[model samples]
Structure formats: C-alpha cells, structure tokens
Target: MVCVKNLSFRLQKIILNDITLSIEPKGQIIALLGPNGSGKTTLMNVLADLYQKYEGNVHDVGKVQLLPDYAYIPEDLTIRECFNLFGQVYDTFNIEKAIQIFSYLNLNQDQLISSYSKGMKEQLHLAFLLCHDVDTYLLDEPLAAVDPLTRDILIDLIMKFKTNSGVTIISTHLIQDMDKLFDEVIFMSNGKILLHNSVPQLFEKYPGLSLDDIYKEVNRNVPFN
Candidate 1:
C-alpha cells in the first residue's frame, strides 16, 4: 500500500493542490481521468519521483518486505535497448513475457526506436513495461497515440497485466472505451480532485450515464485555468 498526504506541486504557478489519497497494490486498475493540463500527468510524475519539488508525504507500507523496483514507461525509447536496460535493472524481469508481447505486437527487436511510427513506439513502450515484473506502474496516456486496433490490443493486454499483484494507474482523457477496466476512478479538474469513487458508486450517483457523460457533467460549468 502507498499513502499520500497533502501532496502538491507547481511550475511557475500551482498545478496540483492538497491532493491526498491512499493506493493499494491489490491487482486493481485505477484511472486518473481529466482533461489536458488538468494535473493528471503532474501527479503521476510526482508519485513516480520524476519531479523533485513537491510537498507531500508518500509512504510505502512495506519496505524490506517487497521489491523496491518500479516501472515507468514514457512515450519514447529504443525498444530493444529499453528491454535490455530494464532487464539489467530489474532482477525479476520476465523475458518470456517480453517475447510474447513483442511477437503479439509484431515488433522487430532489431528496429531502431526512431524508425517506428508513433503508434508503433507506443506499443513498444507498453511491451517493455509488461516485460518487467514491478509492484507499481504509472502509464501516462499510453493509448493516446495508438491506432484503433493497437489501442484495443494494448487495453486488453493491460487488463491481463492487472491480474497480478500490482498497482496500475492509467491516466487518460479517452474514458468511454477504457473506463470499464477501472475498479475506481479519480476525476480531477484544474489540479484538484473533483471526485473519487468505485465504478458502481459513480454510476449510482448519475444514473444512465456513461463515464464520458459523467465526466462532461462534472466539468460542465467549470473553467480551466
């Protein structure tokens, strides 16, 4: 489990404010839903320790009890090299999974990262993440650049990946097609959490509304800053 208290961050001005939440690595997928520049990526970066200037207390319950490694797959990287780099870094890296994902994606190990199209690179990045056996995963708009077919495949793979014991947080603006995969959803607007609830609870509050519909209603009158 991970505990976050009074978390906040800023660039030239405030981006995330007073965010507090607890996450458990119980094979559950969580969605960070928001518009662009709504601080979803910022929060994910902070949690991944990619940004240094943030005020908060993030505590992981098990220190020596569990592996200390985590995986964060950015949008760009050399596919083959990334696999080798992660394999070197993580002792528990699963090469078999890597082969399976690569074969499924039809990615050539010898191809340069710069050679692949945007969609192909995104698929490769996800494949790299699956190759590693980590406790925490922070995927930032992973499906944003993929084609329809690739998006469907990646989403299915993510669901399969979440069947293990790890905390997977997927930040996305495309909610309708993928919302069903989330056990819980965190809606953010202008850097603050608007609502957080289970899928059933959210639908209960707004009857007959799809995730996208509820999201539209949430930020209906609010203006982005």
Candidate 2:
C-alpha cells in the first residue's frame, strides 16, 4: 500500500494544507477528481517524487510508476533512442515489448517525438511508462488532449494493465467518461481530500447524481477562504 501521512506542500507562501491518503495494492483503480488550481497536480507531483521539499511523508511499500503531467521527452532523440534511454535508467527495458507497443499504438519507431502531435506525445509518454514493471501506476491527466477514439484505446490499455499487474491511480477532470473504469473516486478541493469512496458507494449516498454534479456541488460550497 502507498500511504500519505499528513503530507503538505507550500509554494511562494501559498500553502497546500495537510493531507492523508492510503492507496491499496494492485487490482484497485483510484480516480482523483478536482477543479483547476485545486492542487491535484501538486499532490501527484509529491507522490511521483518530483517534489521532495515538502512536509510530511509519502510512503510506498512497493514500486511506484508515476506519469507526470508534462513529461519531457527529449526533442532530439528518436522514439527508439528515448525508449532505450528509459530502459537503461530503469534497468528493466524490453526492446521486443517496446516494439510491440509501438505497433499497437501505431507509432513509428523512426519518428522523432519532437515531430509528433500533442496527443501522440501523450500516448508515447504513457507507453514509455508502461514499459516498466511496477506495483502502483500514477497517471496525471492521461486523457488530456486525446481524441475519443484514442481515449478508448488508452482505457483498454489501462484495463489490461490492471488485469495483468495491479493498482493504478489516475488523476483527471474527465470523470464522466471514466466512471465505469474506476473502482473508487478520490475527490479533492483546496489541497485537501474531500471524499474517497467506491463508485457504487458514492452513488448510493448521493442518488441520481453524476460524478460531475457531485464535484460541482462540493466545489461550489468549498470553504477555501
């Protein structure tokens, strides 16, 4: 399990308050939902080990694979070279698997990432992350800028990951499309977790309401000030 105990972060005097969360092991899919500037990205960064100057602790008992919001794929490197570099760094790179994923995603091995479109870049980033084996998957806005068709493909890939591997934590504002895919929802506001419940439990508590509606209602009355 990945545990966040009283974790907090501050940026230029704007304090992101304390937060506590526990993510169960593999086979669980947690979707994080929040409005813009609500510290969703901040929390993801902290969990991904991108932000180390914060307070409190984020403890992961197993390997965690984090997919950041804007992963920088070197503009000069070819697709193949980038995969090779990542493999070397993680020491678990599989050239054949990488090739298979490229074929599945319809990505050209010779194409440079700098020349790919924004959506393509996002897809490549996800593919690269999946190339490694890990216990927890942390994805930040995996569906951003992706078309609906590609979104389905991405969702399929995630489902396969969970079936073959274990847990995945996806942070996104597009909850409506993902309601069926996630097992639970983690709602956040003002740098603090507001709700964490299974999809069915949340619906049962607030009948006849969509996740988006719940989000709007919560944020509308948030005591942020």
Candidate 3:
C-alpha cells in the first residue's frame, strides 16, 4: 500500500493541497481522473518520487520485496534505448513479454522512437512498462495519442497487470473510454480530490449515471476554490 499525508506541492503555484490518500495493495486499478492541469499528473509525479519539492510524506508500506520500485516511462526515450537502459537498471525486465508485445505492435527494435508516430510511441511506452516488474506503476495519460486498437491493447495490459497483484495508478483525462477499467475513480479539480468512489459504489450513489456523466456533475457542483 502507498500512503500520502498532508501532501501539498507548488510549482509556480499550488498543485496539490494538503491531500491525504491511501491506495490499497492489489487486485484493483485506480484512476486519477481530472482535466488538464487539474493536478492529476502532478500527484502522479509525487507518488513516483519524480518531484521532491513538496511538503508532507509518502510512505510505501508493504513487505520486504527485493525491489520496491516504481516505473515511469518518459515520452522522449527511444523504444530500443529505453529497453536496454531500463533492463540494466531494474534487472528484472520481462524480455519475453517485451518480445511478445513488440511483435504484436509491429515495432522494430532498431527503429528510433523519434521516427515513430505518436501512436507507435505510446505503444512502445506501454510495452516497456509491461515488461518490467515493479510494485507500483504510475502511468500518465496512457490512452492519449493512440488509435482505437492501441487504446484497447493498453487497457488489456493494464487489466492484466492489476490481476497479477501490481498496484496500478493511471492519470488520464479521457474519461468515457477508460472509466470502465477503473476499480476506483478519484475525481480531482483545482489540485484536490473532489470525490472518490469504487465503480459500483459510484453507480450506487449516482444511480444510472455513467463515469463521464458523474465527472461532469462533479465539476458543475463541486467548486474548485
């Protein structure tokens, strides 16, 4: 499990405000749902330990695993280079899984990521993340810049990861297409959690409402300030 207490961060302005939340261990996927600049990505960065300029604490409470690590794929890395770099760093890279995904995505190992299309780059990033063994996976906008087919593939991998006991956290703005995969959805606005609920409980409280509809409702009724 991961816990954050009294977390407040600022980047030229406040991004997260005294946010305290805990993510359960496994058997679930958590969706950090928010619009652009709503602090979803910022919070993900904090959890990933990509940013230290913040107040409060982030504690990883779990067993004595060999590698209590988190993986974050940068958008700039090449497909081939990222594999080698991460392989050397993590030492637990899933080469077989990587090969399978590469073949499925039709990505050549020699090709530079700079030459690939946006969709292909996204595919490469997802492939890299899947081929790594990590306790927590923090993905930012996993569904963006992809065609429908690639989107489905990404979702499939995420589900597979969750089933295997990996704590997965995804930050995304594409609500309608991605909401069904979330076990729990965290709605954020103006750098704070406006609401959080499990998928079933969400539907229970707001009867007959889709995730997208609930997002709109929350934005309308929940003041950002």
Q: In order, how many clashes per candidate?
A: 0, 3, 0
Candidate 2 lDDT tens digits, 47-110: 7777899999889736667888776778788998987788788865567777877788777888
For candidate 1, what is the total of clashing residue pairs?
Answer: 0
- After superposing candidate 2 on the true structure, give the runs of residues whose Cα lies further than 4 Å from its correct spot: 92-96, 162-165
lDDT digits (tens) for residues 123-209 of candidate 1? 666767666666777778778766778898889888866436767888887797788788888899888988877788989999999
Q: Which structure is stronger by TM-score: 1 or 2?
A: 2
Q: List the global CA lDDT of all models.
A: 0.75, 0.79, 0.74
Give the better candidate number (2 or 3) by TM-score. Answer: 2
lDDT of 1 at 108: 76
Better candidate number, 1 or 2, judged by lDDT: 2
**Candidate 2 C-alpha error for residue 211, in Å:** 1.8
Weakest lDDT window of 10 consecutive positions for candidate 2: 158-167
Cα-lDDT of candidate 1: 0.75
Error in Å for residue 47 of model 1:
0.7
Who wins the lDDT comparison?
Answer: 2
Instruction: For candidate 3, report its TM-score.
Output: 0.83
The segments of candidate 3 whose C-alpha lies over 4 angstroms from its true place after superposition are 61-82, 104-106, 110-115, 161-163
